[model samples]
Target: MAVSTLNVQKCHGKNIEGWSMSITNLQAWLQEEGTVVLGISGTRKYVDSVTMKWLIAVLYFQAENPNAALSFYWEPLKKAVRVEGHVEKLSASESDEYFHSRPILSQIGAVVSEQSKPIVSRDVFIERRAMLLEQYGDGSEQLPRPKHWGGYLVVPEVIEFWQGQTDRLHDRIRFRRPKSGDEPDGVLLHQGDNGWVYERLSP
Candidate 1:
């Protein structure tokens, strides 16, 4: 298993880094505490593993808050990969599959909600949801996923890890994907072997 960490406060920065681990532990961590920092049109958000399974693709984030920043984390790949490129939304079929997999109530809610739009009252939303449910569901029929709801895939350009230490002497490791065939200079650790480079940063 591997892990990735990004510091959103530093800007819309992302990194991917992780150590070796068993597949079982990897799945367990993902099921338990897996999380990532995200940015969308100036609003930085934190998407836990559960929420992330749905919103996979991460578009560039630009939080309206002046202090906001965006971050992304992932781990343990077969080969070294780079992030920080164009973000891609999921395909319609992919979106549909994900949507159908969600709870019926979630589908109904997403369909009924106006998203970021302001609402007049909770009662109106409740009424709309009830009506939509009555029309689309009888408990057996699988509801369709909302058109506006889907996932994003964030391919990171750099990967980093931070370990807190005594008195703020923390240990930070980073892996930056090379722009050219020439790999970056540093001691690269690859699958118990050396294939890529990783730099230790002063905290």
Candidate 2:
């Protein structure tokens, strides 16, 4: 998931100091910035989150994985911005590589346990563990990746950026792409394809 911040600029023909400005620029910014592949902590800092406070938006930007993004509204930030996207399970190759790299015991335990199910007790678990370990005996042989163990790729269809000020006044910027495409038209020219639009909202 991507966590991001939104800010306003008074020069953009609206009252940013008054906590309202069009999000055309903000949307463009995300489309461009979201493509960055920094680590989680690096992304947070690189996005310059300190520019916005009071609202924390979670954005899933997977440029390297898939070309998608997902933003969720924090309870407190719900009144600020709203965006949605789709998620896809990771591929078998990805899961298999990770499954085999785990410690042999964990691989065996994964084969035995049904994650997220209600288990009887630790003793029951331990009993199952003992049996699996005795049966497998920690061999270099590979174990199959359990169907349930895998990650997801998220594709964001729309993005909303928001900032807040005093007296419940706030600013909201929404960026939406057509269902058929993701490339956007913006202040800066993107390399290829253009299909995104932006709108300002009352807050």
Candidate 3:
């Protein structure tokens, strides 16, 4: 397993950096702890006045980069899944249930870290964590979920599957909602189950 660092600049000036983990661990972490930093809180004030359209894309690697000192000449074979969707915030009750379901230490950690705000040093988190531990001395009590901390459900609009080939001829199949009068032509577009259509793309 290889450790990779991901740095991303989020909307509203929030940033994630120095996060290193194996691909599998990172994927799991993003589904769990990463949700805490999702930008719903920073834009809450503007939400009332503006139309909010929450969109999200999730990418997964099936066959990853080969482990080698030099891989430039290696076959570009790969497989991946890409999901694009609209997001809907979970209800307050749902969020609360999920938050409390976590381990006590994780709950406290969520409360201590100030999401993406820049910090002066590691001492900031250390001090904050120490203080929180002292306040919640015993693990019997559940920490209240912060207003900004919650969950979202992604309603997939388009899902794409990709496979890379050594001959430089990759394959891509995209599934999406079908338009009115849309019919599968077989060669490029094909009819899929449940009101969906799939089309292949040129590599």
User: In lDDT terms, which candidate is top?
Assistant: 3
The CA lDDT at 55 in model 1 is 34
- Candidate 2 lDDT tens digits, 96-141: 6766766878777766665434677778778877877776665744
Candidate 3 residues lying further than 4 Å off, grouped into runs, are 1-40, 43-77
Residues 18-122 of candidate 3: C-alpha lDDT, one tens digit per residue: 332222111112342112112224321112111111112111110111111101112254776554544445567977887777777777776777654678998
Error of 2 at 77 (Å): 11
TM-score of each: 0.54, 0.42, 0.62
Query: What RMSD does model 1 have?
Result: 11.1
TM-score of 2: 0.42
Superposed Cα RMSD, model 2: 16.1
Candidate that beats the other on TM-score, 1 or 2, i.e. the better one: 1
The model with the greatest TM-score is: 3
lDDT of 2 at 3: 36
